[model samples]
Target: MLFGPRPSCIKRLLVIEDDPLTAFDNEHTLKHAGYDVVATVDSGEAAVRFIAAEQIDALVLDLGLAGDMTGRDVARLARDRGIAVLLVTGRCPEDASDIAMACLDKPHSPSALVAALKALETMICKNRAPRKVAGLTTWWRPAAA
Candidate 1:
């Protein structure tokens, strides 16, 4: 039998923000928190591709991206792919869409984002068993940890 140790539990995240300053700040903070930032893009289109390519465990998505597609669109796509989402934006509550994970308004401190990500990570970890949602069973760990 081929026996090997389970892979490391490094969490991967994708950041989709249009503002240059915000993107830089978020990338710096998330990296400092030990998340593997797979990709940082200014457009929702690019963000979608990054999620598709990487084993993205979560997303720190902005509500306003610099492209025809909005951040909500990116969130929806990511959710469909079983990627946990954390919405950070200055937009109003009513503007929020059907995101699965935590949501935080913009102008938030790095600590706040980190807390939300941690909660999302815990939620994902607890629900590692395969679940059928929307008639689809998304990829999830076997609670081996």
Candidate 2:
């Protein structure tokens, strides 16, 4: 241990999206943005399996997934395991702020998605307030002193 604080790095990610086209785009965009896309799954079951087995730093989860479990279910599970989450949907769920680090609305640009993740990383890992970015509703707050 040579450091006072661990490095703030949010790298590996799992994307759970029901739409094949959107999933592809999210995976492609995140990889281009320098994140390791560990896996892109289309259902909650697959997402659960990945969550149980993989070392994921974050999730890009679609609210309406193609399985019994909704994105909120995955978000809760991921949070229990200390993984961060970024929920994506047309309309955000009512309890989104409780379960995710941030939420992003649908039909957003790839650049906007990338920016949202950057902002989330700053807030979650760096513990610093991030500048506002379009299409992101952040839920991260600094821990109380």
Q: Of the candidates shown, which would achieve the greatest TM-score relative to the real structure?
A: 2
Model 1 RMSD in angstroms: 8.9
Model 2's number of clashes is: 0
What tens digits encode model 2's per-residue C-alpha lDDT throughout 6-78? Answer: 2247789999999999999998988877788999999989999998888999999998989789888889999
Best by lDDT: 2
User: Which clashing pairs does model 1 show?
Assistant: 89-106
Residue 74 shift from truth in candidate 2, angstroms: 0.5
Against the true structure, what is each candidate's TM-score?
0.76, 0.91
Q: What C-alpha lDDT do the candidate models reach, one value each?
A: 0.70, 0.85
lDDT of 1 by residue, 1-145 (tens): 1112221343788888899999999998888777778888999989978877788888888888888998888888888887887787775345444564656767887766666665555456665432222211123334545
Q: What lDDT score goes with residue 121 in model 2?
A: 77
